[model samples]
Target chain A: MKRKKLRRAEDLFFTWVMRACLMTAAVVLGLILFVIFWRGIGALSWEMVSQPPSGGFYLSQGGGGVFHAIVGSLYLAAGATLLASLIAVPVVLYIHVYSPNGRLANNLRLALDIMWGIPSIVYGAFGFALMIYLGMRASLLAGIITLALVVLPILARTFDEVVSMAPRHLHETTFSLGSTRLEFLGVLLRQTVPGLLTAVLLAFGRGIGDAASVLFTAGFTNNMPEGLLRPVASLPLAVFFQLGTPFPEVQARAYASALILTVIILTISILAQLSISRLGRHVIR
Target chain B: MEATPDTTIRPLPAKKIAASRLSRWRWFKDAGARTMLGATAVIICLLIVVITAALTARSWPILSAYPLAELLTGQVWQPMRGLFGFAPFIAGSVAVTLVAMAFAVVPAVFSGMYLAEYTSSRTRSALKPLIDLLVGIPSVVYGLWGVLFIVPLVRDHIGPLSDRTLGQFFPFFARTNPSGYGLLAAGFVLAVMVFPLIVAVTEEVLRSIPREMRETLLALGATRWETTRCIMRRAALSGTLAAIVLGFSRAFGETLAVMMLIGNTPRIPSSLFDAAYSLPALIANNYGEIMSVPLYESALMGAALLLLIVVLGFNVMARLVIMRLTKRS
Candidate 1:
């Protein structure tokens, strides 16, 4: 009886310890969110969001905002998303429709998995090399191309899973109806549209929030993005530069930029989740 | 149905139907998609190849100038002085990654076990989303948080406490200056950043174990702790190892957070308190000014090449382990 009681006590202790471990993660996340919001709220203002940085902005004299960074991030991410989609959609369709369960498809999946694991910094290095070879300086177009390469594998793999989730019978039924392969693909695309959109948004979220991948290719500028040939500033770089300075106000701006980045990521994540559920209703297991 | 059958007595001409189906637009539509998709696949493969080729080509100048052995084994890394030994950076990378893994492994394992074996569905649902959010949070945000909170906390609290308590016995804990912008700070941030990935992967591994095995262990009078620690954990050992490796790869390749918090001094740290430099951090920190010097770009590219090779090696090994585990279970 005494031994039984001791075992029970040990079990209770173990359970509580595990609970605490789980709670620690939650607490850390909560703490990060709280710290960012608390530190950044004061620095946020209308002019800060709407206007570009004025002269001597990095000195933390507080005469500038993050409009240029925001616009640049959006433009780069949007352009990359569009380019990635053009490649990813066809690749996904080809794997699932044209050559299902073939060696090419399997190899493609493996390649994408490997590519997905490559660090963003490596992509930046590769992009830098390419830009040098092409006699191109840092420009919006360069950044877009680099980001597209970074996100293509990600978008392709995600859409592959989404397309694969359609019931096998759906494909069989379309083919059995004497419809052409193109029509069958059209039906499949319609069925997975929500998931495809979610995948694109997720890739966009990743592209915009990333810093290392674009650090070399984009080349920061204080002005708004003027043309495809000109350099563009992004939020992640802005945060990095601002925080690196010795001035306190610049650090505050960094926090505010982080806050904006966090919001964008969270919003994208929530949207992705919502779309998954909506797609679930349409998907036939 | 009977009316349609009677109407079908007058059939359409086969030649006309064939001609319509074989129209240029239809044939083009049918063939165009395959060509487009095939081209896209080729592009995907070509992109990966191009990246590899570009890194190698850019790195060749330095690689050809300096022997690989010297670069890997030399001590110093002064670019301006033309001394480009990557040993310090390599050691720094390994040290910080090991420190982060040391801090992160226990909590990640326990959290994974809790989620996999103990939690109710409701609690799991609530908690999983939060963990997923952690994975989505950008590294820059982690860096910002580290600078704002972790650096000060470590410098003010942990650094002093460690110096007074453990510094005497273990040199690893000793601090000369204790500014807290060093391996310990970087490790803490990396630990937090990688915790979610480790937990997620481990939880999946544990959950893959058959329910029957778990029930049989419990029926044989094993406690829940024994069942999980002895039976389930052993079964998933390879997978857990893979998870650890995956987390390590992430820590090794991490750039922004480490750069921000690691007090980017290129030295081989003797204690956790000393500042260090990592390959990725070095590349990111110097890429902007790299073009000023003749061979500086090549040297940085060499570092990047080393990082890429190491990260890719780890990823391939982890994927293989995962594949084997999946086959087993």
Candidate 2:
């Protein structure tokens, strides 16, 4: 009886500890979401959403909405994702279907893995130097191109995994049918569409969340992006630049902005997860 | 095996057409495929080379202009007057990372241990998404929280508590600021940021330990904690350290949140409350406005190279540790 009581006490201790840790994580997440929403809801007026931030950040008055930032972020992220996807798909397909030896493939994979270790700030510095040399001067083209470079390795690595999952029989069957290179590519592309979409969305999520890489390359301009070479503001940069000021209202607005950005990313990540599972179901079926 | 005279696809000579279509397309067997694959490998390798070259080119100008002694030992960072000492940035990065790791490692390991060894599948499944959500939130958002909430709360609450505790033990803790968004606060937030990575990797490593080992240990009447602490943890030590190092790398490279929270003053932090500068932040804030051309740019790249070296060093060390562990095990 005494031993049983001791065992029960120990179990109780363990359970409570686990519960406390989970609860702490939940609380931190909740607190961030709550503060963002609570402060941001009032700041998220239609005008704020529609107009651009003016010369100065004003919470209640003239500095307008996040329209340019929203549009710029979407355009740049979309452009980067599209470019990265296009480049990665072909390379990944070549690696998956045509590569003869494993040694070269292993080296490529390690190179991509090491790319992840390089800091975003370093990427920004590189991009900044290149942009100045190319005379892009903090334009949209500079920003989008830099973003594309930053996300290229990530997209390639993810797509390589997704493409490698294509069944060997599919390739052999296509070969047996004497499909041309283009025809084989079409077939492989059709099969990997869902996985590729997931990879793109994941890339998009990453692009959206990135800030430091964009700051030096994509100079913040209040005006909406007009051409491929115009300056633009992104959500991360907007939040980052605004958070350090003395204005409480501007600070609160930053919170709301962050919340919105996180929600968008969270939605994309969930969608990617869902698509992968959906792809699994299709495979099983 | 001569080609047919009426071959429709291409008007080739009989000898050229003698090769089967399969052999023609067999790039893997043919030199063409080998060349293409080899070229692809070269392209990937070139990207690494280009990035390294870019970093080197960027740093070269600055390093040439500034002597090594001044860059390494100098404290003041006046870009206008052409004086840039990166020692304080290095110190700040080390300070924040160490404090963050301290805050994050203990709880992260314990929680990871419990999740892996103690929790039921249902709980694990339900709790995992929540943890993932924490991980997915962007670092800038963390900075926002640090600024608006954490700073105030720490200033109003934590500082007093620290003051009272340190009042008995140390004089340094007495002159604390309420702004919790200093080195300690940034570290705390970073700990949260890296918690999921450590927990996930550590849990994965722990779970890979054979179930029978746990059962065998338990069959000897050891308590769950005893089994976990002694057998599972010991076995998974390499993985745990790797996870921690991975967390360290992530924290080290993290820029936006750390930049926003760590008050961007270029002073050596005597106390946690004093504003600090990190390498990434220093580059981010000044890279755009660098006036001395190569000198400032090189300093920034050198800082990046420094940060890169730290992360890569950790990665290499972790790999070595895991290799050693595997050999011994």
Candidate 3:
């Protein structure tokens, strides 16, 4: 009877401890957001988001903005998401449609998982090496290719997960109609469109937020975004560069850029959540 | 009554495509898709080999110039004088990753248990979006938060408090540096980034535990805590380890955030408060700058290659352990 009481007491104690742990995590997240917002809100303004940096902007000479960075980040992340999708879709489709149970598919998933584990800086180094070999300069194209590599495995795996979640009857319906493997894939793809969109958004969020992979490949520029072959400023790198300066105003700009980035990510996540709900409605499980 | 009308030369069901009616164009598309998709899969599978090979071939110049052992173990890191030692960075990487894992694992495991065993499905669904937001926040922003909040908190509270108290128990707790930008701060920042990640994986692993296992424990009159302890230690051990390993791989290769808060001094640090350098930091800070020295770029590339190898090695080890565990059970 005593031992039973002791066990009961221990159970009650640990339950509270676990709940406290969950609360602690949530509180930390809240504090982080609060800090960013507190420091960054002062720097937020219409002109700040509307214009690119003017002459002597880092020197705090004139009106400055991160419009270029906002644009550049969108362009680079979209291009990367597109490039990654081009490769990821075909691979995921082949795995699910052609050989879902084959050894090759298993190996392919493992490879992608490993690739996903690699750091962004290594991708930058590899991109730099490839650029040198190709006799190319730090251009948007180079950054796209490098960032694509960083985003590829993530896109592929998320796509695979979404595709896997597709109702099993999708296979029965598609194949039962005397469809070829590719035709069945088309039907399945149509069903998981919402999940696929969510996956793309997730990958885009990852690609846009990473600064290391594009540090060298996508050369930074203060001017507005130009052609594909030219340098483009990115939001994360903008935050990094502004913070590197000694001037207080420039550092404040860094805070502002971080705020913008945080907001963008929050929006993407909200969209992803909406799409996830829509996914259930789209398919009859 | 409609049997005669059924023979009115009805066309094939629009959706049900039969092989006999497959047009020449449709045939080409089918064949093309197979060839394209199969080839893409093959290339994607070979990507790991391609990345490893590229990094190695690029960094071989430095490895060939100096003995591998010396490059890895030597202390000094003067790039201008042709000295290329990575000992400090490696040690720093290990220390920071250790600190991050230490701070992250407990909270993550507890949260995972709560979500897996306690929460209703409604609560779980509502909480997922919050977790997703946490996971999606960029590391740079986390670094920004660290600079603004954690660094100052350490400078004001943790640094002095630990010095007065923890220093009595152990000398290492007494820090020489008070700027609050050091291993502990970096670890804290990194922990925030990885907490949600570990939680996600842990929840997956714990939920994957068979219902029968839980029922059996309860049927044996075991309390909730007792059952949980047994299950976590035995049944969920491998998955939890894999989760931690995955978290470590993430913390190991993280660059920008650690660089911002680690105070970027290239040396082995004795105290947790001392500034230290990391491998990813080494690559990120020096990769694009002047390459006047002959083997400077090579040395940086070597750091990148080493980072790649370490993270991938851990991932592969975890994969093997998981494969073995799943096979056995």
List each candidate's DockQ score: 0.48, 0.44, 0.56
lDDT of 2 by residue, B42-99 (tens): 6875775686677777777777777878888899887667788888998888888887
Span of ten consecutive residues with least summed lDDT in model 2 chain B? B7-16
Q: After aligning candidate 1 to the native by TM-score, how far in Å is the CA of A9 from where it should be?
A: 5.3
Q: Per-residue lDDT for A26 in model 1?
A: 87
Error of 3 at A197 (Å): 0.6
What TM-score against the true fold does each predicted structure earn? 0.92, 0.86, 0.95
Off by over 4 Å in 2: A1-16, A54-63, A98-101, A160-191, B1-38, B67-69, B114-123, B207-227, B292-294, B319-329
Worst 10 residues of 3 chain B by lDDT: B6-15
DockQ of 2: 0.44
Q: Against the true structure, candidate 2 has what lDDT?
A: 0.75
What does candidate 2's lDDT look like per residue over A1-285, in tens digits?
Answer: 899779768867876776687678788878878876776777666765677777666543446667788788998899888887766677677665545235666567666666765667767877887876776778788888888877877788777777777786777677667554445666887888888887788788888888888988888977888888778889888787666566877766676677678778888888987888776666511
Considering summed lDDT, which 10 consecutive residues are worst modelled in model 2 chain A? A94-103
Per-residue lDDT tens digits for candidate 3, residues B86-118, read 999999999999899989999888888888887
- TM-score of chain A in every predicted structure: 0.92, 0.85, 0.97
